[model samples]
Target: TKSLSSNFIKNIVVEDLASGKVKEIVTRFPPEPNGYLHIGHAKSICLNFELADEFKGRTNLRFDDTNPVKEDVEYVESIKQDVAWLGFEWDGLFFASDYFGEMYDRAVLLIRKGLAYVDDQTPDQIRETRGTLTSPGQDSPHRNRSVDENLDLFARMKAGEFSDGEKVLRAKIDMASPNVNLRDPIIYRVLHAHHHNTGDAWCIYPMYTYAHPLEDAIEGVTHSICTLEFEDQRPFYDWVVRECEMPATPRQYEFARLNLTNTVMSKRKLKLLVDENVVDGWDDPRMPTISGLRRKGYTPDSIRAFCREIGVTRSFGIVDERMLEHFIREDLKLKALRTMAVVQPLKVVITNYPEGQTEWLDAENNSENPDMGHRQIPFSREIYIEQDDFMDNPPPKYFRLFPGNEVRLKHAYFIKCEEVVKDADGNVIELRCTYDPETKSGSGFTGRKVKGTIHWVDASNAVPAKFRLYEPLITEEAEEEGQSFLDHINPNSLQVLDGFVEPAMKEANGGDKFQFFRHGYFNVDPKDSTSDAPVFNRIVSLKSSFEV
Candidate 1:
């Protein structure tokens, strides 16, 4: 975490400390272990960890595993890895299941105080009776159960005497209240599924609305922060703490969640994409999950800096995705190694050069940073250039290779096209060029200059590699009123090309990143690269029109 910036949350914390309302700050990030964490979760993680760090306080990582039907140990482990990869450590690790016994006792206390009762209505009946926004809900016939009867029924419900959904405990709040959340909300239900944390110890589970507030209060949290979608639940959150007579009172605050253009942040939709095989997996490079971004070559420093730049606010807005690409390019400009790669190979034969001969040329690893030093590249009689760099019929002001044009090779002598070889289909397959030895690069011969300079690889020592280019997974246009988001999936999102790169890159390992001379920054694919051959995934383009 870096220094605290000027934001609404920081201002509240500052005032709290100045007025002696809070002696020490304690915050937490509570995530349900049902699916992988997405980029939206990254904002909450940064806000919680950095805010506590700024005040010399502590933060906890807690799993609100209230629903066991969808929870798994696999998701739990992935969440832990994502947080550590983001460069932060939790002071304490906890789970909602850790307080199951205490939560049960609190529910019993509610029954004894006549604040709750056991309702025998089915799930459908309960929802139907819950009135609309403009009307008041009717009271349940079983709302007046005696304290003794309610306790006995609740105990039997927890003891596995009843089937799932046969009985439920509900708080006896006013159904006529304007807020629908206070309309006698369900607190506990019978679920016969085995929990990932407590196993068969629990047959009935508490609802998330009931478990969340108790978890925060029991942990002695000073500030409970969440997204704006949960703003409506804050009233019930406070009601639980007050009615249960918890020793600590934790206040809840809501901030706007992160939304990015051309990306869906919903975990349900992302899980569907993984389950339906629409993507490779949760870690697919095109997905917006943290693991996906990590596999795509985003660094921790860049993500943290972006979160800091966005800041915390109460208003909702969508951020353009190009802004994120801008930060990564800035972070890597001086760090990534600069090299040459010909992704679309066009064969070229230097007729005037010596046959079966090669020479080594010196090139800087990264011209922007001098301390990286220079590297050696082999130049031979046969070379490969970009297929797009040649033209059969030259257009006006075209600077690349043509019938009578001369162009300088990146680090070698100037070459002029003399002959073009065509195949049966009239497609130019090869070019025969002659080099002027006096006009070699790095020499003092500045007699003339060519308008075009292209990068190439020596054919004798080139390494075959696979290059993957990507576009936006979702289309730029907004969806129509009645169309599904899946209808807008781009069919041409990924394009794979067989290419050749410098021999020095043959030994590059997974997670290594580099910048191709005219291409973009790329990462060695960790999932598919081997020592004999390498696969590169383009991180982002070399330039963008986005400002700040």
Candidate 2:
């Protein structure tokens, strides 16, 4: 099989095919059901699933749910949904807990063969005796137990005869090996907590290192793909599979994990962001969770494109945030509808229009897609424009608004700022503008070319809405050295603006996407939105050209 590109993992797979070392590619995405999938997981998911699909193979969705202390059914369902949302399907869904019985039997096999023993040392004592990277470890007194004694003790441990953390079964590997993981690693331990999927049927659980390879073998997975952090553990993984005499051995390949700028991918840190109420919840628009991205108006195709562009590699680096925004902008340009919203509104009165009469103006739904068609927007004598679009005094290069300055009202007629009114605080309260009846947009407004054009909503037809703006969650690089991720928490990642929009916005249901003409990309929030009071979340700013 020829690889699509030069990624090291793909190269390895190609060679495997050419050598006839493997007949069909089999890959698995094994994630612990501890936290919701973030952007990093998207990369891994795409890599394994895409490769398998390309090679006419299949991918398995396996939950490494060995640690019941933090795993739950809620996370399991979330993982499944996220994977499916990413446009991938599992050949079969399996759990490490599902194979606990066979894993325990394998441990018993190793014990009866005098290849393993139960260690009673405390965790700290074991750690201290394990020695350092440059030193050799001393053997434990319990390491020399007879095969029958070890088998009896291990069986008794499984029958609920041992307390949690009191004893652990370890592989009788070389104690003086240079690699610490090869120095008699723990294969199983007594975790008395009830499993989420297996329930209280068993108290003894196998360690991750001992279970992962076995699961892959039993499923006939040809390749076990994971991040670079597990490169060293591959040896121990092979040892477990080969010694257990599994029917087949699956090779493990390593790639660099995705690290993005201005975000934290650590599960523990993300949990803090949720528990502290720093944001609304896990699905907060500012969060990096899959649900958060979905709520923020990000399309799955855009995320998939990002993963495809980033490619797979053993070399690691932090990807720029602007690249993500770039793909999102490219995706929404043709999909989200266009509308006029007055975020910081300033009153403007068209003195020439009829006082009591209102008319409907035609507006394009999406300029990029002609088939999307158009809608009628209300236009009246009184209107509201952006407060920052006007100036009380004239300034150079300011084309928006000023006394005697002419500008076109987007989709409407040309207007001139005739007068300005001030309040008691000496602040510009209103702008009195004069409109030209003959200069209506698309109605032969060709006598003069307006330097600037602005968006507005009819005062009588404006709908009240809640606008949410988001910034980066963290100010520092995600993979920076010696820097605490908490130190970079942006105090103002989210700011809510009580603003107004066109009356058509009032009919918008949750999950509808729209662009606030020259403002930014926004979506109707599925949470806390209704027909009367629409809540909009800013997906990304149009002005933010995040250059690397």
Candidate 3:
């Protein structure tokens, strides 16, 4: 119970109970069954389910399936999986289509009471009639239709008597209402597409505004929580519920939706990217989708931590994407095991060590987690180091490798750069380094320190692996507001390279996580990894001076 007190949703419920307005808290996460759930949806799921948990109440997973053209069972199943993966359980599952029959009957009742009418105007004509914010809307010719004629026409419209959009049932509200949404909004439209769950049970379907409130009422939901964009439509939502005389009246509350920086959260924009094959699919690791984040080695705890840290706010705000990366890196720091991987390999020959000779060197699995113990890595005469680790000419701040400069080879002996071998194009082809046998790591040698340390893998004994490096999906922070979101797509978001890893990594199956020494956290890609050749996706980089 104390845990619930920390979340703002619980605080709201406590006030509701203190005021004696509600005996139990009830909430619902209503997602349209149209697209794969993304990281943004995770925020709403945690809020609804966690609030219900705090008050010992129930939360329902409802699909607002009003539009059959864009809805699908595939999306519905993916949403359920994503919610469950986020560590939340729904007390019930429902659909707007379940109340379609009841919703249709309510429309007929409204028409009979002179509260609704059947409009024969085309979609374009209705749009032209509903004026802009500065102008008052004009009434449709069918607005003054008699109650008896309206009822008969609506019933016939549902009985396959009206072509799709040829006729629509609209509420007889004031056309001059400044709110715009309350101006005789359409309650039901004729659509012939087959419903995912309801099938071809009816040719008429209820609009989202008309069915959302009714769905909440039927489920006995006490509080209908939604993003702020729906605030304008709330009046219409409430009107339908009250006129229908539902057994219970559900209240509506609005909060700002999550707007993440450097990423687009709109499903429509994400769909465009998917259709255009900008990335891979909806679950590409570069995507903001929940499944994509999971595959990218993001823990549920990190995501939950991110949401809890931001909490619920009344005003809109953009959360810095770095905050999310910070939590992820923090969570994986002490957990992920450490290994040696050379992404951009360069030959480093330990000339002093015997040729064809190899010795086992002890390396801690995770420096932050000592209890994780240690693993033995092979140290041999020749190894592969990072290409950037060595430089033919050293600058003032370049502490890595240079001719006549010494650096420690991580977990092995300290080596001084004795010579630099070059190629025809003037690229440094190899580093001829001489090792100090007495200055090996853990040898307890006195005053044995190097300016820098670099990671390496024994070339002959190492395993060939694939390294996938990723960057921000968008190059610019906020590209022109009115332009297509894709205009800022980062051309070099992902760069795949053949890399060298320690022999111990050969035993890892797909999905294994590791922190490559001096590199970044990485995970065995669930796709395109096998026993002999592994593909590791860079999870996140280690905190360095660059981040500051």
Clashing pairs in 2: none
In candidate 3, which residue ranges exceed 4 Å CA deviation? 1-9, 477-482, 544-548
lDDT score for candidate 3 against the true structure: 0.86
Listed per candidate, the RMSD to the true structure in angstroms reads 1.8, 2.0, 2.3
Candidate 3 at residue 69, lDDT?
A: 93
- Poorly placed runs, candidate 1 (over 4 Å): 1-6, 476-482
**Across residues 389-418, which tens digit of lDDT does each residue of candidate 3 receive?**
988877898988888888888998889989
Residue lDDT tens for model 1, 258-317 = 999989888888898899787889988888899988878888787887888788889999
Worst 10 residues of 2 by lDDT: 1-10
TM-score of each: 0.97, 0.96, 0.95
Using lDDT as the measure, which candidate wins?
1
Q: Select the stronger candidate by lDDT from 1 and 2.
A: 1
